[model samples]
Target: MNLNFDFTEKRVIITAFFCMAFTIANLITVKVINIGFLGMETPAGVLIYPLVYILTNVIADVYGEKIAQRTIILGLCVDILFVFMTTLILFLPSPAYYTGDSSLAFVFTQTPRILVASYISYLIGNFVNARITAKVNEGKEYSSTKNLGILAFSELIDNFVFIGLAFVGVFAVTDILIMIVSHWILSLIWSAIAQPFTKMTVKWAEKGKPAEA
Candidate 1:
């Protein structure tokens, strides 16, 4: 039996690994930073969260749906493990001389509502993004426009689910609406801005391979 390993395959695996790591890290620190503008508030996670979708699209485009789905599931599992570990750490008594304990707790101690929201939003968003991208790519070459459209819808769903679930009772109705709209719009714009880089990544990943139909 003969086995083949290639640079492009290695790049795809590395990219997927980083994307999964980023997703978990971003979720963990999502509440660490909050910003307000135009009388609306949103978590700093917005800036980095779109990369997860972008990378997932690239994987689905260059590799396949199965790999992308597996990546998303892997990310979810990592996130769960991260949450569990952080919770355990939060429970342990801080060293008497460790001055950063408060800061660490402040950053890692997520409320139950926010944690649930993060899980729901991420699973639904990444799954939908990967599925839609795969379905669109079937027998068709990559289309940034179509991909953007799919991503926009998926992000909208993600923002709605996350904000609604996390802050429905904690914030006023209007504020929640603002958060959803702001997050959805910003995420769409971020993905659009990153489209060129995504194309480059996909092209790089697909190098030395037959072009898709």
Candidate 2:
């Protein structure tokens, strides 16, 4: 299989950071946080996971779709490794001196069903996001509205797929629906707040060249 290895220090740094962020988000996703708006609760991952999309858009804009897609695939591999290592740690017996074993297992024990849901949703959502971002920007000037729209739509798909698959039997249908809506809305808000930083990063990546769609 042919793969692109084109690299600069900055691109490598950004891709590595993206993978770290992805793994961290996955590890923390089991923790729910209250947003204090309408008493809504969402996975803590929502706060940081949108950065994956934001950075993907930056990559697609600057390096093209192939590189962006490659980055996503690399993130998947890293996430798999993270899961494996964590599971290994969880499966091994803890020494008598270790007091945090129970807490660690509680935090890291994700059902295989949820893991499947996460991987499927991540691949589908991220690829959709990269494709739309790349397609919209082809031979055109950068448009923030369009970028945000792509983010909104992709985030919606991601929230729906993950929540629906992971919680179908564990939660009431209404509750699952609420989770999807709440997570999507919160993710969009977070992405909007991060837009300025994203734009600045894209501009820097462009290095004096105008950004294209």
Candidate 3:
């Protein structure tokens, strides 16, 4: 059976594709990625996750928080789909190339605790970032430096929630605190650097929105 999907006026599909790509790449990099910045070691994961946030922000800027919230829900749905599919595949018989289920376990066996944390934190933090950006724009603070405050605060929460979920107890408490701080700070830096580009992206989107009507 063939399903005729609507591509025109399909912002949800577009946003979901980008978010899925970001999530896949972010998952890969989270295992081992660190760099020293501002006398702190930061995870390279920030490079990818903030893009997701920026996309959400741009969605909110051009469309509205309602659409941005929809995108966040889309992300959560995709994550759940991944979890379910992986679990189903892991149970199936393996081919000869695979010695055992190690690879399956590696991919699908994230602790339930971590999975729950990741799901909750990601949905909350992402919506937080997008909502703040949307609110500021709606309030006509787009031209003010207060817009930067939106970025700073939201990115901090984004990084905090993500890193804390990804490695709250996996590392020592002290190391986890430092890592959380580093991830948060690095995300803030990326948000600032990317906000200008986001304005451009949002402007481009706005131009197209009226055309779609």
lDDT of 2 by residue, 57-146 (tens): 888878889989999999999999888998899889878998998898898888899889988888888899999999999767677788
Tell me model 3's lDDT, rounded to 2 decimals: 0.68
Which prediction has the highest TM-score against the true structure? 2
| Ranked candidates, highest TM-score first | 2, 1, 3
lDDT of 1 by residue, 1-213 (tens): 433436566555656565565555455555644455576556778777888888878777777888888878777777777778877887888778888877878887788887888879888988898898888897687888998888899889888998899889888998899878988888899999988887887776676665542
Tell me the lDDT of candidate 2: 0.87
Error of 2 at 206 (Å): 1.7
Model 3, 1-213: lDDT tens digits are 654334334465459665785567436543555474455765455667777777777677667788788778877777777778877888899779888688657756666776676677777777786777777787352442555576667766755676677777688878877877777777777777877876766555554455443
Please, what's the RMSD in Å of model 3? 4.7
Task: Name every residue pair that clashes in candidate 2.
Answer: 137-213
Q: Which candidate do you rate higher for TM-score, 1 or 3?
A: 1
Candidate 2's C-alpha runs over 4 A off are 1-7, 208-213
How do these models rank on lDDT, best leading?
2, 1, 3
Candidate 2: deviation at residue 104, Å?
A: 1.4
1 against 2, candidate with superior TM-score? 2
lDDT of 2 at 93: 89
| Superior by lDDT: candidate 1 or candidate 3 | 1
